[model samples]
Target: MARSGIQYADVQQAIDALLTRGDAPSVQRIREVLGTGSFTTISEHFRHWRNEREQNRDVPPPKGVPEAVATLATDMWRQAQEVANEGLVHYREEANRKVEAAQDEVLQATREAGDAAQRECALAEHLHHREERMEALGAQLADSQAQQSALLARCNNAEQDSAAWAKDVGRLKTRLEQQTSEHAQQRETERGLFGQQLGEEQQRNEATEGKLLALLDSVRQERADDDKAQRKRTQQLQARLESASEEGRESRRELKAAEETQAQWQRRYEQAENEARAQHETVLQHRREAEALHERLLRAERTLDAEREQRIQEADWQVSLSQRLDALQQQVATLPATAPENDDDKPAEDHSDSPPKT
Candidate 1:
């Protein structure tokens, strides 16, 4: 009685046609036409229809039963009951077959549904795991970003410190250069003074040689005059000889004194020359020390410059790292919540392959 739609009417007609043919249609065919796999459902509907028809037959005719036709109605009722019983038996057999087929179909559908549900559950679990992995990667990326920021700050400070050290080194180099120049000038002055003193000593030695030569000529002239005066006065010859001998002795002593004075001057000159040489050597040693100091300062300045450049390079690297971190952060921010799928309902590993933060 609940069968009220066109689809239900069509199914009832199909059932009647199958019954009339004395061969019930296969459940597959019914399912193909009815778009349902349940044989029990089909059998139940047929049972309900047969029961409704039988109930109608069992009901008494509406106010038309007469005694004269009672015997005839009874005979017709017996034959109708026999025919109904045969039809019911045929319906029952068909219902059993349909029920078996429907049960098989339901079981198959249930298995398929179960398999599908299992697959879906597996996929959902896999997606959940992937989401957790992505979340962990994002957290790691955030931590790396934080480290990069701190490193960048430290690098910037190092660069500033290097620049200051470079400036200080530059000032120190300038002062060292000035000191070196003054030392060089002093050495030149010392050399010039030494040369002038040597020239003055040489001139004094030449004048002393000229005075000794004149004194030797005067002694020769006096000896000749003494010989002539002794020949002229025989009586006073002895006295003159005595006087001449005293004069000769005095001249020899004077000559010895002059020679000793000249030797002293020579010794003094040699000492002065040796002192000058020693002073020159000392000055040269000082100059070498100054030069060495200057070289050391230059090397130190170069080292400072190299260190400064290295710090600057490090700073640049830190800046680049910060930029990369910023870019990675931006990319993370723009990532979609739901990952896209391909044919297999699996999310691709796009974000996972991204570079490290910074």
Candidate 2:
């Protein structure tokens, strides 16, 4: 089973937060902040992020050896060329000497063979008249002819050897030319490879720069969204507070009206009590005139008591209503001045779409 990590937006937010805290983001640090990504996945994304950053920035070319070293290399190459040319001249001279020497030996052998033949002819002419001398002259002529045939064979062998040496020299020269061409081609290939590597590095740098710009835009957009949300939440709180203020005003009006009604009832009760007192005084004066009036006076006293009790109950109801109104005003006062739009300060919950950030 594999655990998923946060969404790209969340990861970006985390990175921005880390930057705000002056911390660099690495695979391990990002994972620690996110608390859920696989190490391999984090490593891959981090590599991409770093590449984007590098592309946005300029990268200087790698420093090679100092100018002194380059000068030294040039001098060494020149010396080697000079040395090779000298060796080639020496080799050609040596080969020509060998060929000339071989030809000279062949010519000297030919002249000696001709001289031997002439001397044998002279001996034959001088010895022709004597039979014993003629017999000895025939043996010498046979030996000379054998020696001439051996010399001819030796000359033929020398010619064949000379031809082989010429072919060997020609092949060696061709091989040297091929080696020189191959060395030149090798240097060309090395230059091509270096140029290709440099171009690739430049391309990588450009890509990194583009990515950094995109990330910056994303951060800006997110900030704008946050600000908008805050403004909306503030407006909502203000509207709620206004509604509560209206309700409080309505409650206060009702309370004031109840107090006015209570005062009117109190005035009515006092007027009734005054009337009862006047009737009691008239009853006391009439009791002396008529004993029958005494019963009416007692009934009037009972009616006054019932009316007083009813007024007391009404006053109690008014007081209860006033207290409830006060309580409603307190509740309206206690309402919060502003409501939160979201719990952004707290860590987010894990969901299918996104993981938690630490």
Candidate 3:
């Protein structure tokens, strides 16, 4: 009669198949081969099968069997047992390797999960830092904008002041030109007066010479009678010539002084014009500098805006990474906490004792 367990035949057949194919078999392997038995049931069935084979071998030969035949039969059974034992050892080693590999895989998975968590934390920290940087950049940009506004206002004021200064310069030039014209007219008037005075003096000198010539003729005609009168007239004519020469020299000196005064006025006018030009040039230089500063500010603002946009993009990417990390964390949380049912019913793997012999 068969031992307990309806799967005994199935287990025996699975073992037989493994032996035919030169494969080591175990309770776990038998379950794998059958695809539908628990380890406890399969191990029980395998033990029963081993017992039946051993019992059949131990049955004494009937009707005086030959000693050589019995010895040969025993030898064959021993060799079979040895082969089965060797196969079992190889199967146990293979099972141990598989278990270790499974443990290693579990460890690897745990490490990967840990690494993922660490990465998520790092990403969160980095995101926070990015947000802070973005805030700082925003503040900086606001400050820059305020500064730009102030600078623009200052530039506008400078431009207005420059315009006012230029207008003042133009007004001054106009006034100076008017003064110069008036001064020139006055100088012409003085020159005309001096010329008239000189002409009158020349006319008086010519009249005196004519009168002296007439007196000389009279003295010559009178001879000794008018000698005293002629001498007195000659002395008066000599004094008159001396006085006219002195007046002409004084007029020449006055004209020379007037020319010098005109020259001084011209130099002053030229100096004022040069000073005005220098002021205008200075204003132009200031305007150029302001323009350059404004241009640089514009470029910096553009750069800041671009960086702000890039930071925004990075912030969005970080958020996506955070979402992925959340999903991963959830998956890790859902992992199984227990081993498989087959592992629970697994047969003893460390025993080296062979099956009981007949």
Candidate 4:
């Protein structure tokens, strides 16, 4: 028979075959059928089978064996068993072959299951890594969004500031234009006034130049006349001196009488010369007084011209003021009249209704 502890079903089949053949089976033949080289391994299988049989004693073996087969001899029985064991060994070998095949299939399936579990663990790790990457990307996206919002807000504020500055610039430009126009008008008015003053001053200067030229011509004429009178006086004095020298030479013959007459004539000539000098001084003094009077008249004329210009300016101002006053009076005259209150403290209308006049 195959080893008794080989699968119970397998051992039972071999035992059945031995009983049917009417022979005793040997241990060697059983070992050969079991295909086990180690006695220790066969012993471990028998111990396991004995323990299982004790626990489940009521269950029968898969194949039935007669009780007589257990009592056979050692040597003749071994030989007889060899004949019977031949069929039993073949049956046991077939059964053990099927069991080994099933065990190898189970081992392959277990290895495949372990490989699948390892792949599943690796895929789970990859998924976790991808999730962490996605979280970091999401955080970066959020920060970028916040920064964009801040930039947009700053742009909006800058736009508002630009608009305000533009408004201020426009207001300042308008004021500048108005001021420039007013200044231009004032400058024009001042230019007109200065032109008028320049014309008046030019006229006064021309008049003064004419008077000065006249005065210079009179002085030159006076100097020429004085030079002529001085030459005549000098010729007269030279003639008188020659006559006195001749009379003195003649007087040497009549010394006392001629000397007294010559002295008297010299005294009279000296007195006349002194009187002429006094008259010349008086004429010079009168001429200087006349020149002073002429200068005073020129100054007075200049003052009069200035006064006339001032009067003209005053007249223009008065005329403007009068026109303005007239306009104001006309405005006042055109205004509506106020009503007086009566004894009843109610205002009365003073309307004089008439046909509309053209």
Candidate 5:
């Protein structure tokens, strides 16, 4: 019972028995008769049984009925025939027994009548009672025949019901097998679809992971290139700054040297100016001495003429002294101008060492 839940075969047998008794099987009554069954399980199978019955209900009974139903019907008819024959035998035996009893009474009456003529009237009365008894036995035999006919009709109806039920059970078994095959086919199709979808999703995830790694490498390369460019630009700017700083220091040194040289030239100009003034004073004194000497010569010439022959040798000495004085005056005039010209020539030599302009 546990291995097999209530099946259509169980329900079919139960329906056949109920149908033979002319009672319709219901869910509640089938459970009660089986003694161990789920109401829902019984109800389901019962529905299937009813469907089969409806399909075959209108069909006519077949001539070649199953052997089991035919055998059962044949046995019932044979039993009815045997019972009727036995009843007929009992009726004939009872009639014969009554007829023998009446004959024995008639024999006794004939013997008694011969013994006495006065007893003949009593014998006639006994014959009338025997006729009444015969009529009662005949009525009982007619009732027995009527009961045998009714039994034959019930047996015929039972055979028809059993044949109809067998056809219904056969149709239900075929339908159940078809439904089971279709359900198995549908399950296989759904399983295949699920596996295909899972494989596609896995492939998509792998492709996405590869793309993410490529994007990361590209970003790192761009960052390295930017850093290299920044360092190169910084190096160029540093070089330019150092070059400009060296040029600035050199310019400062040149400016200091130029300022020192200008101060030295200014001192030299003051000293040259003082020497020119002193030279001018010395030239004036020399001119005065020459003028005094010229006047004395003129006095000397006049005296010579008075005593020419008295001092001829002294006159020749005075002429020589005048010639030497004129030559000394010419030398003093040229020397003073030429000294300042020599002082101007010294600055040109010093200027050559000074730095060029910025």
Candidate 6:
């Protein structure tokens, strides 16, 4: 960088000022006099000024001046210029020493600045490496967090499934309990109905027996009177007696059929009782099955297809039972009422074979 604005005229003016003050003009002195100019600018201008002064110095003295006087004045002026030159030399030495010291300071400052720059560069590189490491760590942390979030979501889903499974188990258990209680009640009701029907049948059979016996005795008495009172009516009396015997035989057969029906009913009652006991055992088995179901709930999802088929089969079986019950009821409804002896013609419908569908 060079200082600007210093012209030849400015340098020349400064040099003349120095001469008027009786000081030797040098580049440093002219620069000092001007107070603001570059050494190169002042030196170039001073060179030109010295060339002009040299050319003018060889010119003759003024027209009025004598040769001897002018020569003495020139000697004296040369001697004074020599003295000023000596002082300029001393000033230049001092200026050189100060300039050297300034240069040393500039060199020292440059070295310190270079050291600071090196330290700053090293720090910037270290910071860059640190930032890269931080970025890598942050990426790893993000991956870990994503994995953890996935695991947590899976855990939450598993927890929800477990809760629903537990609720289903409790619900099934409650339903089983209710069904068991109802089955027991149904069994007892059927038992009581069967017992009542059995008693009623027995009573009806006994009453029919007594009425047949009385009719037989009355016929016997009429036959004796007919035979004893009139010989003419003997054939008719014999026919009437034969008819009474046939009626007794028919009545006896009906009584035997009634007894057979009673025995059949008794057997059915026992069978019903057995079936009820079996049903109770089935309930216990169902309890065991429920326990097994609870133990195997984890397998529930796997068995869904198979269980769907099972449920379909069970539904069909229930439908069949319903149809059978309906048919049996219609049969009973269509059966005609008969004499007390033949009252047991309608067979007691046994429905204890199959448990009721839930």
State the lDDT of candidate 4 residue by residue for 271-315, as single tens digits.
645654565565556555555655655565565566556556655
Provide TM-scores for the models: 0.35, 0.20, 0.40, 0.33, 0.22, 0.38
> Between prediction 2 and prediction 5, which has the larger lDDT?
2
The sequence of per-residue lDDT tens digits that candidate 3 reaches over residues 225-291 is: 5656656766775676567567556656765766676566566656656665665566566556656
Off by over 4 Å in 2: 1-141, 202-358
lDDT of 1 by residue, 1-358 (tens): 3333335455566654543433333333444556753554554454454455444544554455465455444444344444545555565566556556556655555565566557556655655665575566556556655655554565555555545655655565565456545545654554465456446545644664465466557766775664465355443545644665565566556556555655655565456456545655655565555556556555655655665565566556556555555554454443332111010111111222211111
Which candidate achieves the best lDDT against the true structure?
3
Better of 2 and 6 by TM-score: 6
Expressed as tens digits, the lDDT of each residue in 238-343 for candidate 5 is: 5645654564555456545544544544455445445545544554554454455445545554544544443344334334433443443444444444333322
Worst 10 residues of 6 by lDDT: 338-347
Clash number for each model: 1, 6, 0, 1, 0, 0
Question: Relative to the true structure, how large is the alpha-carbon lDDT of every model?
Answer: 0.50, 0.50, 0.60, 0.48, 0.48, 0.55
Q: Native-vs-model 6 lDDT?
A: 0.55
Per-model C-alpha RMSD = 25.9, 85.9, 10.9, 56.7, 98.5, 46.5
- Full-model lDDT, candidate 2: 0.50
TM-score of 6: 0.38
Clashing pairs in 5: none
Error of 4 at 16 (Å): 17
Candidate 3 stretches with Cα past 4 Å from truth are 1-233, 337-358
